[model samples]
Target: MNKEFDDNGAAEFEKLLQGVKPLAQDKLHFRPPVKSRKQIIENSHRQTAEVVFSDIYQPLLPSEGPMRWNREDVDPVEVKRLRRGDYVPEYLLDLHGMRQTEAKREISALIQACVRQNSPCCCIMHGHGTGILKQQLPIWLAQHPDVKAFHKANKEWGGDAALLVLVDVAEPTQKR
Candidate 1:
């Protein structure tokens, strides 16, 4: 390789570059920084009312009766169908013997996997013992971005002891 460039070569390069101009900037163009997952979740929590299990649960409700919820965007007919157990769940998660923390983690994973797989419906069998899981399940489901709606399973499907969740195939943008 050549040890060095000739001085004339350097001067020629500089002269050729001097005529070139830098790219123009658009002063009005602006974009905010993308939020991290934790930040997005924290923001979502702040925007929605916190789910308190005690406030939401009704232990006295009969096991044979149906309990249901639907987002504003969900159709009324769809909720009716869910209440009737018309739609079969494609995924099932049984949190029978699991602790609260473990159940929570499992539910989150299950819902995410369902969404990724584009499965629209899932069932969770969380027995009606002290009604702890039954009570807390709604709160967790409500917080989940992918969950569009949820209803208590029908008599044949575990009744009050289980939940049939309707998951959105697409990523959820706004809070429910």
Candidate 2:
């Protein structure tokens, strides 16, 4: 059978692609999805597959003391590594003048972004201006499940005014 140009088929193809556009490079995922489409939900307060941060119960944290926390399963050495400035922060968030509510949301977004980008380590500079955000940062971070560990930054990364956090993400599988 010899092929011939079918005008109707060509018109249908054009119609299908008339409004289609390429996905943004930044939005593209290079790795396979961790969860099925049904399990993933995207919203202002929800980004990660099944993680949410709550601000209701504030934990006991020293107002001016060095901030540090880690999940029970996480090793203490991880916090030591953060204090040593071993893992350079892949993302930095400066919450200078925002209120507690706004600061919380920004932190949530920061963690979500870090996980999506496969950046296990990041920094949050809450500043020592009013000491409001500074005091609240660790409380909020401790509530998130993805926050594996965090410690007060060393002098190089801002010292007493910032925190270095380690987010939980799957390690890249090596190809044999």
Candidate 3:
């Protein structure tokens, strides 16, 4: 064996690689860096505007008329069924004699509880008095994201004085 070659193998290897050029930078393509899962979730949450209730009350059309609201994707037939009181409410919140502020709080809490319990329907009796509650209830219900649909209760219930609210219950998230 050659003494020089055996002793300087690393030097000889470096000499062989001296003239070799690396691949062009433009030809070495790479995908853009992906966002972390937490970052994506935070971004999504940030993009959604917070729901605010202000100046929601206005003079409703008729004092005797039934009030109704439904999401655009909800079926009209289902709304008709709700109007007819086909589905019995699992819970009820009577806001009959309560003031506007108290009634609003009760309504919010009741709806949230019902949603958490996965209750499909609920009733809110605002009564047919001076029509203050009746006028404001629809606006408040419209603002609630979980309220899928709501209509004046049927005659068997409180009729125009009460509302049959259909709540959308989100499925419980499964853990990985």
Best by lDDT: 2
Q: TM-scores for all candidates?
A: 0.59, 0.67, 0.62
Kindly indicate the candidate among 1 and 3 with the higher lDDT.
3
Total clashes for model 1: 0
List the candidates ranked by TM-score, beginning with the highest. Answer: 2, 3, 1
Per residue, candidate 2 scores C-alpha lDDT tens digits across 1-176 of 12345777787899999989987767766897588564554354544312454556676554565788888899989988888878999899999888776677678888878878889999999888978787678878888888999999988788889999999976676312
Name the runs in model 1 displaced over 4 angstroms: 1-65, 171-176
- Residue range 9-108, candidate 3, lDDT tens digits: 9788889999999887676568888899988855543332123233454423334556777877788787789976688999989997898766766777
Best by TM-score: 2
**Candidate 1 TM-score to native:** 0.59
Count steric clashes of candidate 2.
0
| True-vs-predicted CA distance for residue 23, candidate 2, Å | 42
List, residue by residue over 1-176, the lDDT tens digit for candidate 1. 24356777888899999979989986875779889998886554444423321244433323454667777788867777888778899888999989876676677768767877778899999998888888778767766667788888887778879999998887456324
Deviation (Å) of 56 in candidate 2: 3.5
The list of candidate 3 runs beyond 4 A from truth reads 1-52, 57-65, 172-176
